[model samples]
Target chain A: METVLRDAAAASRGAPLRALTVRVGPLSGVVVDSLRFAFESLAPGGPAEGARLVVEETKPAFRCPDCGTLYETPVGDYHCPACDSVRGELVAGNEMELLSIEV
Target chain B: MCESCGCGETNPHLHEHGHGHDHAHGHDHGHDHGHGHVIPVRSSALALNQRLADQNRGWFRAKGWTVYNLLSSPGSGKTALLERTLAAVPGSAALVGDLQTERDADRLRASGAPAVQITTGETCHLDAHMVAHALDKLPADGIRRLFIENVGNLVCPASFDLGEKVRVVLLSVTEGEDKPLKYPVIFREADLVLVTKTDLAAAVGFDRDAALANIRQVAPRAAILDVSAKTGAGLDAWYRWIEAPAS
Candidate 1:
């Protein structure tokens, strides 16, 4: 929970960290459940001890470069439904970001 | 769940037997609880690594070096290819990554090029920070070409940026033709796709056409090269691609 301690500068050093929320994108290659498991197993004896870990999944979003069509993959459908664009820029779903911490 | 902390507790972040506190950041003014607070971080987990990677990219560019990040499965002949490349090309250096041991680095150094080994312990992929640290250990200067042989994995290395001028993904002929389709993340990031072990293609019943088609399907933009490091068959073309600057 080094990230939690670093970001929890507002709280006292020994303040009991209550929770942690993180944003996980689809293309980030991180499993949400596994992340929670790791956090739970590692949080003890630290500032974030007994902290509840919350992981929010981001929908895989893609922006068509040619037709400017925005698409989301909730069902593993990556191709643009609006336009058949081969080169779609990833607008989201490629990040593993820490959102906030409560202490 | 409470909106502040996503904790089911009615008064989330509120301390039991609360006391008036002089905490840092002063962001606890609005909430019912005065002592507890939720700080918004809003930063990537890999922020430090990404920043270091950008710095490495800048430094390599300043030195006019063409660095290639080589990725493949274990036993895909990445070291063999590098051994040949270091022997074939002049002013080239390498950084080989492995879970343990410095054998790959020793083999590369024996190829008559300066090579450094980065033992990652238990890490599956080589992050930018590790490369920056290992770059310090490498002593050779005026390195025209720098090859960073990433840990032999198809999955994890795709997400880490190593500040390479280009990424070369190797798919050995012994590995099935559908590997590109299976590991699309790494295949899609390829600037060059090298089909290694061509000398054993026939003996291994490797379908060259199907493999080329699969590579084209996943990485249409990457320049495909069929190279047999054992026979030195396609080494000339790979060397040419190295010498020719990015277009």
Candidate 2:
């Protein structure tokens, strides 16, 4: 995290890096809040200091055909409450990426 | 400078003066001074791999193939069942994912079904990107059923979507009947719950009713099938269930 900030700052040449928003999915095994906390703590003294860190949470969407119900499951199960379809379609989740960086 | 201004000097008088300044400055200051070098960055940690996964799903869709993501714990008889299914049903091929080695895939090939082994290296689960890459490298000729036998770990595999038409969750009778109740979320997303290794049920003190009841308690509507890939006891039911029309 410090290295990331340092590299971002080093690349900026003290010009000022703006807001950095990150997309974190539940499946990525990264805790969004913890990452945000780390970023806040590490960003204060570096080029990321006061650099707006926006954390976007991504969740996996699942739909059960048997029950005709669509809902979001936690990082664990994908079962539908109305119908216990173990093989429902996973519409989303498993996302982690750098959306954009403002400098 | 410290001695001249009495700042952190060795004298008690200097300490007193420093304490006084600190106390005096404790009052609220209305002016707000923002810090410099704020990092303005928007990015996802999984952005790179997720892009690849999307492309993979698109590729599978373009080919008109129905992918089944098979998930279960180690020793849940996932590979064994696949072997039996291939033997029973003629038109199925598989891409088996594992941490290392093609042992499972090699065994599967004995059923006269072509299978590609996807070694995940150190990863616990088979993610979308790996499936996509494996699909590109596999022979996509005259195949109707495409099975993605995920690395055997219930926790991690539940989090990924490998673009499967069905995400089948396998449970062995010997593993305890409360498995589904304990892991409801995985069972919740399962299109079908297969209770495997039932041939050894009696020997292993496996309670069929208790397990079924537990699964029912969590996922009452899950299409449950009991089978022993060894004795071929209930595989026909499993095959029929898999071949059932997708509405």
Q: Which candidate achieves the best TM-score against the true structure?
A: 1
What level of docking quality does candidate 1 show?
acceptable
Q: What is the C-alpha DockQ of each candidate?
A: 0.37, 0.16
Q: What RMSD value applies to candidate 1?
A: 8.9
Task: Output the number of the DockQ-best candidate.
Answer: 1
Among these predictions, the greatest lDDT belongs to 1
Residue-level lDDT of model 1, residues B36-109, one tens digit each, is: 46666666766655666787898899888889999999999999999999998999999999999999999999
- Candidate 2, B4-96: lDDT as tens digits: 344332222322111111112234433234533333333333333345455666667888776788888898998999998877786788999
TM-score of chain A of 2: 0.62
After superposition of all CA atoms, the RMSD between model 2 and the true structure is: 15.7
Tell me each candidate's RMSD, in Å, in order. 8.9, 15.7
Q: Cα miss at B237, model 2 (Å)?
A: 1.2
Candidate 1 global CA lDDT score: 0.78
Q: Write the per-residue lDDT of candidate 1 for residues A11-87, one digit (tens) a residue.
A: 44566677777888867767677777777777777777777777788887879888999888642335667876546
